[model samples]
Target: MSNTSNFRDAFRQAKTQALVGPNVIANALPYVGGGLVLTALGSYGGLGVLRTNPELFLPTFFGAIVLQLILFFVSQNVAEKGNNKVALPLLATYSLLTGYTLSGLIFVALKNQGVGIQGIGLAALGCGVTFIAARQIGSNLSEQDGMALTKTINLGVIALVAVLVVQLLFSAFGVYTPNWLEIAISGLGVFLFVGASVVDFYILPRTYKDDQYLPAALSMYLTYINLFVFILRLLIALNGRD
Candidate 1:
């Protein structure tokens, strides 16, 4: 499970972590931006691999995914404990691996005449817009409303994840999602992550004290990344095959 999932589970309880981290969300923002920059670099590197060594891409991508899973737990634990020195590099590596994993989707987006570079830019811009709106709306959410939305989005995410696993399994057997189904799945994903982005603004501060900004950054990073992925997917789905 990811660090974000752990925090999600933790927040399911009635109690919350004490407000130890004053201005924790603010502290986490710079790292979030830095991590995104690293992710962009990593994606560029992965694109190089895809262009020059296509056969190796799948193996390396899977390897990156497994390593990212391991690193997620380790880095989140260390960061939450306020061990910045140890956690920083680990989290940075984790972010890079995430970007590597993302490259496959990006590759598809890039190759399609419909999606191209412009679609990628739109996907990124969509995430930025979601962050801006989420910050505005989520920061103002009342506790009751926030919790309600969290529970709703959590359930949706669980269902969506299950669906994606099934879809991936089918894909391995040479079955593919129909265009309409892809559109539906991608649309739902975009909605859920946008909602999740909003929830992050509400929950992160309550869950992590200002000292624990790294974990907070991790959670937010995951949110934006997923949002970007789905927005790109939705774009591809709507545009259809080239």
Candidate 2:
């Protein structure tokens, strides 16, 4: 009976740790961009990673996707072995690929013609503040889901899929709409992203255990990326108004 009780306590602690880990990671991810920018600056000055206009962004973009996918699978398999060492390298690799892919986005934002350094600075500041505030609040929040939570999460997933589909269609058709529309869409993306963070917050503790860091990191990374994208779009839209 003592052994059984200890086992249960261990499981509970692991779950709690998982819940906290991703939020910590998400908070740290914004800092990673700063690191990448420094690296880019050192290598190519302002024109390093973000300055080059490539007609073939798809190759690098898809390459990042492929790398992320590979890391996901590798992490999953390694996690099954109940060892975290196997997963850390995969996490590091994903982080590097993510940073590389984001260099293009940073470049595009700076070169948007409508957007200037002030606008970029404002957006970065806004996102950094939001990331810190949300993370702090999330760390203390406790989620005990009932039927309502289930329905909410399900709806969140559906909303996410619909938004993604529409975004893809618009991109495919080259449908350049009003800047307000883009901003509105970005606002919705932010809403969805925050919802996902809440869901992840609840999920990590319930579903994760030893060797779960990689999956947790991946989830937080996705949220970070989505948040960044929408924040950038909002900045661009605001700049367009000026």
Candidate 3:
């Protein structure tokens, strides 16, 4: 009788954890959505400000980056300690700062070519496709599959960083890339970031602990932001081509 009772208790505990795990991603959706709205507002707001005080753009852009880095590291530290109280606030602030920086880029693009609406539309479409793919992939992720995806994502990120570094070095040497190469790089960036968002969303529920929802949300938010930036860039590149 005692053996049966222990087995039942263990099963209940396992079931509870399993149930709680998926809610992490579900709960994160609202935060990610909120961040997106904030991004749009910040972009518009930054553009408005830039019209009057263009000199502030560089300082504001770099300031947002520094602030975001600080908030991100602090949020991660608190989340690691399971302190949602501190982590949630930090995450919110970080999201806003990220939006501010993104807004600066949008402002630049708008000033250059007035492609704001089209750029946003393209980003939305990319996000929609990425979300659908992620949902399909996440629904069927076993533990082994999740681990394999994680490894692939890590490798992909490393390769992407290396490629970017090479490009930057070439630029430093005043080496000009062909137009085709620029377009290809822009397209590849969009593809990579979209794939990253899918992987992040797919593994989020399986990977994060119960109290680590903030960190999970942060990861997803960053993925989405990167996806938006890359998609927007790809759109602009194609527009320029035409």
Candidate 4:
């Protein structure tokens, strides 16, 4: 399961195969839905902690990041080996940690003018729409088209990660992305992930067996999470910074 920058690593682990699991995507949908719910719960819990003991947020947030990364690699290995029993809880925890990490940006979204709950809802809606559209578009793609799009999007995503790393380092030194640059970055993020959402549909069946639904679900979950983040960032950028 992969939906973010981690996807590149996951893809590198195995070469793509012929379509093996027609029902795998369907089977994975429930877990994907469940993961999103858990993520929301985790986000809510994070928000509560932020409100009650703001001082604790930074350390715990960083701790969560480290823990999530560890759990992610471990779970992906276990799941790839078909050890769902161990992997399920690990992935559950990973989702929660991811939501926890998202709290800071979500908090910012909550406070930004013209981009409160409504904007959050719109971001979510945007993912839903993208999913619906991607399913149709990606499913119908010819091999030539699919491969081309996948290559293009993956390259774009790698480039975006590089730019983001640079931006993060700059921010750490008291420099920040300019408003125009912020908008560009965020907008590109949304575009790339929308393309990614489509790529998942095309790639999953080709890559995973029916029993490998856990990884498939993980792939979809991270896509939506990233999509939501970028959409929220785009809205904030467009609406003016807080």
Candidate 5:
């Protein structure tokens, strides 16, 4: 029984590595394509749309989350087939669509501030830098430390959800005031999500190798998107009027 269990573990790891190569390709293409298209739209067409209907922004926000969930389930189902070639393309397409949906951020920022997009840039920079740092630190941690980091990441998600719930409640009540409390909550959220991103990156290449490519790509994709949104909200919380 011990030998059998060991063999299964070895097989799973090998499968995950096989998927990694194709997953990386599928993952990169969507980001590049969707990014270019959205950048153009936001830099040009997005402005007019937001001006005409500000409500559209709500759909973009909600839609991204919904689509993200859908893709997650789909990826899981694809993983069961033991063939990543087809799954890679689906993941890439999902990434592009997600990019298109997120373009609304550009319109929202421009409408708030007159042609300035510093908030968006800052958000991106914060996420990128934090992700890089977390990855390096995660790589260096001892096995025991790594396990502790995993616990931290999980707890961070719970804390993040709690914060989101409170924020939503405040917003719904029409008293969404920005205070030190809110600032602290948002700051903690940023840290948690950044930590989660690093943990996800670390786990992807090793544990989920069965459809390693899709899972890894999906993990990072989710991380980047969450990081971006969190940074944007942090900017709004810090700088926007109450």
Candidate 6:
């Protein structure tokens, strides 16, 4: 009788220790929302500064990029090591820096092309649709499907890097890219980033422990920002010839 009781107690403990998907999602939402709010504020502030002092544009843009990259790697390291205290702040800082960099592009789009509102609206729409799709796709994932998705994500990253490298080469050589090529690249960016967002969302519940919510949220936040930026650029590029 005692042996049976012990076995039951051990099984109960193991069950209690298992990670709960809903609980992880619930814990992550607040951090993701907070990151978005910070990004919005940073973007607004950056736009104002750039508008007031156009001469500072290059410095501000490059500085934000550098800072964001640093914070991103550091945050990833901290998060992977399960240091929530350090990781959360680092992630927040990275988001704000990214917003600042994006604001420079936004300001130019608004002033030169007058497509700011359209870009914002489209970005919001893209985010909403991506979130819904991610949830639907993520919830239905089995272990086998998750493995396949992992491979897809890896391939997606490689493709994204190749695209970026080609764009940089064109820029470095001062080659005049055709309008159609620019539009195509922008469209590709939108698709790639949205796909990344979906993958992140789908894998979050499957991989992360409840205590690892900070990192999970950080991953989603990065995807959200990337998706918005890609959509914004696509919209602006499309409107340029109009």
Best by lDDT: 4
**Tens digit per residue, CA lDDT, model 3, 1-242:** 01112122222333222434667777777877876777677777667767888888879888877887777677766875778887777777776677677776676466546365766776778788888887787666775665566556555655666776788799889985666676777777776666666566555655565556766666777777777777776666666632
C-alpha RMSD by candidate, in order: 1.8, 8.3, 9.1, 1.7, 7.5, 9.8
Give a tens-digit lDDT track for model 2, residues 20-118.
344445443444454334433432322353446455555766776687667656764574454657665665665566556556556667777776566
TM per candidate comes to 0.94, 0.65, 0.80, 0.95, 0.69, 0.84
Task: Return whichever of 5 and 6 wins on lDDT.
Answer: 6
Selected candidate, larger TM-score, 3 vs 5: 3
List model 1 lDDT by residue over 1-242, tens digit each. Answer: 15347547536532663455559889999999999998998899899999999999999988998999999889978987899999999989988988888888888899898999999999999999999999999888988898888889888888888899899999999999999999999999899999998988888777777788888898888888888988999998888855
| Cα lDDT listed for each candidate | 0.85, 0.54, 0.66, 0.86, 0.56, 0.69
Clash pairs (backbone) in predicted model 5: 16-209, 16-210, 19-213
The reply for model 1, stretches above 4 Å from the true place, is 1-7, 17-22
Q: Which is the better candidate, 2 or 6, if ranked by lDDT?
A: 6
Best by TM-score: 4
Deviating ranges (above 4 Å) for candidate 2: 1-58, 117-124, 139-154
Q: Note the residue pairs that clash in candidate 4.
A: 1-215, 1-219, 2-219
Model 5 score (lDDT): 0.56
Superposed Cα RMSD, model 5: 7.5
Taking the tens digit of each residue's C-alpha lDDT, what string does model 5 give over 13-100?
4333222442443444354344434434433543454567667756765765587557656754684455577666566556555555
What is candidate 2's local distance difference test score? 0.54
RMSD of 2: 8.3
- lDDT tens readout by residue for model 4, 1-242: 23554566444533654677778889999999999988888899899889999999999999998898888888878887889999999999998998898888889999997899999999999999999999999888877787788788888888888899899899999998999999999999999999999988887777788999998888888888999999999999999888
lDDT at position 59, candidate 3: 91
In model 6, the worst 10-residue window by lDDT is 1-10
Q: Predict model 4's lDDT versus the native.
A: 0.86
In terms of lDDT, the poorest run of 10 residues in model 3 is: 1-10
Clashing pairs in 3: none
